[model samples]
Target: MQETIKKIFTENIQVQIAAGEVLPSALESAAFTIAQSLINGNKLLCCGTPSCHMLAQHMAGLLINFYETERPCLPAVALAQEQVNLGAIANNDEHETFARQIRAFAQQGDLLLAIAVNGNEKQIISAVEAALTRDMKVIVLVGDDGGELVGLLGPNDVEIRVPSKRPSRIVESHLVNLHCLSELIDLTLFPQEEN
Candidate 1:
């Protein structure tokens, strides 16, 4: 068991590193997209399952706050949680609630970040599809190659795909990826210029 755990950890690191290779640019793009949305007074919706909700909250916090920089700090420009919730609502229902809420929340110039592993959840896929239909930008943080999801999320959406091994470790890697995105978003949202 110890050896197995160690092996899993090693694989997780490799997978995380592979995923991180695309993250800097992806993070930059996501930050720019989010900042542009906020500047335009657009709403942002972030949703995932229970564990992913924790990740979402963390990302939201970072996106709405300033990171400590050597120069100075700045205020956030994005809408508050409530403001974001205005057109954004989380789907907690076991049925179609997730997809339905995502569709309702997305609007022109809005952004939706959907977190899922394997992209098997019909509701999430449907939500991404629905959001795309409305011309909303959708980003998917998926755990595998995203076979069908890749097609649905489209080339425009940033798909942060992690390797398929040790499901638990994949989740851990995702948490790390989310943290990096949040940190980058925080820095961009509250740039030192405003300070």
Candidate 2:
């Protein structure tokens, strides 16, 4: 059992390190994109699959509350955090749950930040499409080769793809990536004075 635990840790670290090598620029771009939208007085809309649902909300909380340092609340909404009535709009469809919300809440220059345990989440793909129709920029956090999602991104969007094929490792990398993005956004939007 101890060996299994250690193996998990080792693999997690290896995946993170590998992702670190290729994902920095994408993370930075996503941070800047988010900051720029906020600067333009646009809010962020987030959604994801069940596996990534908390992560979507976590990103929203980081922005609306604070990443680390206390700052003014930023405009961010997690679309599915407490949507008890999504069924009415979604009609049992996955992405429609988010797509309906995105169409109603999203505006030009706003941003949609979506997370996927893998690239083939039909819900996320549909949500991304909906956001595009609303003229919102997208930043997708996906694992593996971005599956069908690789073709969905537009010129101004960013895709932070974790290199690992393991779902657990991808999720862990995503959590860390969110933290980094939040930190960069804070630095960009509310720079601290260097002592």
Candidate 3:
């Protein structure tokens, strides 16, 4: 049992380190891109698979409320829960649920931040496709070779593929990635004014 726990911890750290080596520049680009979109008065739309959806909501909350410290709320919305709560998801096609919301809410220059813990997140890919048609920039955090989602991204989009095959490690790394992105966005948007 102890060995299993230690393996998990070690694997998580190793994945993060591998990600840290390759992802910094991509992270910076993504953060700056997100910040620029917000600066242009465009909102952020987030969605993910069921488990990853919670991370999407967390990112939206951090942006729309506060990340680490108090700051003016930023504009963001997590798409799936509202549909589920309103009972729309059941009525609408499950695959198009997020894509439908994106068409309804997104505008040109808006951003979509999507997290997919594995390569099999079909709905997330659908949402990415929808967002693209509306001219929204996209950032996807995916793992396990990025699946079909990788094939879909255009030159303008960003895909932060986690450096891990384990779903747990992928999800954990994604959380850390979200926090880093949120902090970077805050820093970019609200640099402390010199007294």
What is candidate 2's lDDT per residue for 8-53, written digit by digit as tens? 9999999988988999999989999999999999999988788998
TM-scores for all candidates: the values are 0.74, 0.95, 0.93
The reply for model 2, stretches above 4 Å from the true place, is 81-83, 87-89
Ranking by lDDT: 2, 3, 1
Between candidates 1 and 3, the lDDT winner? 3
**Among all candidates shown, the one with the greatest TM-score:** 2
Backbone N/Cα/C clashes per model: 0, 0, 0
Worst 10 residues of 2 by lDDT: 81-90
Score candidate 1 by TM-score against the native: 0.74
In angstroms, give how far residue 165 of model 2 lies from its true place: 0.7
Writing each residue's lDDT as its tens digit, candidate 3 over 1-195 gives: 999999989999999999999899889999999999899999999988887889999999999899997899999999974456446454666778898888888889999998897756778888989999998889999998889888888888998999888988999999999999999998899886767
Q: What local distance difference test score does each model get?
A: 0.64, 0.90, 0.88
Candidate 2 vs candidate 3: which has greater TM-score?
A: 2
Tens-digit lDDT string for candidate 1 (1-195): 999989977887787777777666766776667667776877667766554656666565555553344422222222122223434233243435455665555667778777777777675676677778778887777776665777886666777777665557657877887777656655665554563
Q: 120, model 3: CA deviation in Å?
A: 2.9
Which whole-number lDDT from 0 to 100 does residue 191 have in model 1? 53
Best by lDDT: 2
